[model samples]
Target: MPAIISHDTGTDAAESLVYTSQPPVYTYTTSLISYALPPSQFVTPETPQVAVGAFIFTPPGTSPPKVLLLRRAATDSYPNLWEVPGGGADPEDTTLLDAVAREALEESGLVAATIVEFLGTVEFGTSRGNWCIKYNFLVDVEEGEVTTNPAEHSDGRWFDLEEVRTLAVTTELMRESLVKAFERVEELRRSRGISDPVS
Candidate 1:
């Protein structure tokens, strides 16, 4: 049986991984879909990875700002722990922001209205032997229902400012990320008039 891998969001997206004992074969599909990298590029286990976080914010209206947090399945990293919707930057994504948006929609069915700002970057080494630079982004999502991608998250919900402040997690890092995400959203909302009702 051959293993397969795919990259769907970059300047060079290599979709499908064909693993065999052979020396590897390259095939050009379409004008927009050929990637030069081989299967080796997909085997990045210990490599320091770059990740993008989607801090998808909802308007305050008359209440405090809220952001979506997804708790990954126990089989996944940070199992059963809540974090912003996002994932690592793939070889296909043109930018970190695009990864955030792509991962967010994949994890939770929500589209960002716009990427408001880049909060900052945080470096962390996981227990699973992977180190990553997590790039956090603040995004304004169009008002609508949020649907969770069951494969990724066991639970997903929007946590308001106060709930965010007290959300439980084992690490200070995640706590800080959520707190910071809320702060940034507040600043973005007020400065950009995001919650202002149109007359």
Candidate 2:
């Protein structure tokens, strides 16, 4: 499952809608406390799925090597917890990359230039329920600084990889995914004889 923050800016009707992603097989219902979802849904091996996430990396600038993180505002589920930029894949999205682009634009106001590689998936644990997968990808930020959606996230910051390693990440699965991807990025750079972008 993926959650996003949205607001009505009026320029576009979608700006007013905050979108979330669950397996397409599931339907959402209304509730006074929060949106209601089925207790459990099943997905077949052929079920339609979407990939929606970007592991953003910035070469060391004024700061040491940095990656972006969003602090989720206290709410249902992972309230007050921090996460990388991601959401559900949109129905209209023709490809996983398309879903990734839309989520990045809505949540972080960042545009993607290219997808460097497919890092893989992160499972949040059975406690989070089934019927969903968090697809992670390495995206090259083509341009622009990050401006966050106030509704979904309280703040956004750039943190050194080492720094994030020191923090208490609530989800161990995601932490392992990030660490592996980060190492792969470094390995690629080394294979090409490219120096650390952040250095």
**Candidate number achieving the greatest lDDT relative to the actual structure:** 1
lDDT of 1 by residue, 7-73 (tens): 1112232532322211122222233122223313323565468777777655555355566788778
- How far is 26's C-alpha from truth in model 2 (Å)? 30
Over 62-148, each residue of candidate 2 has an lDDT whose tens digit, in order, gives: 234456788776663576676788876655663455566567767787765444456776544333344456667666554576888
- Residue 170's lDDT within candidate 2 is 48
Off by over 4 Å in 2: 1-51, 60-63, 125-128, 197-199
In terms of lDDT, the poorest run of 10 residues in model 2 is 24-33
Our model 1 lands, by Cα RMSD against the true structure, at 11.5
Worst 10 residues of 1 by lDDT: 2-11
Candidates in order, TM-scores: namely: 0.68, 0.67
- Separately for all candidates shown, the number of backbone clashes (residues 3 or more apart, or on different chains) is 5, 1
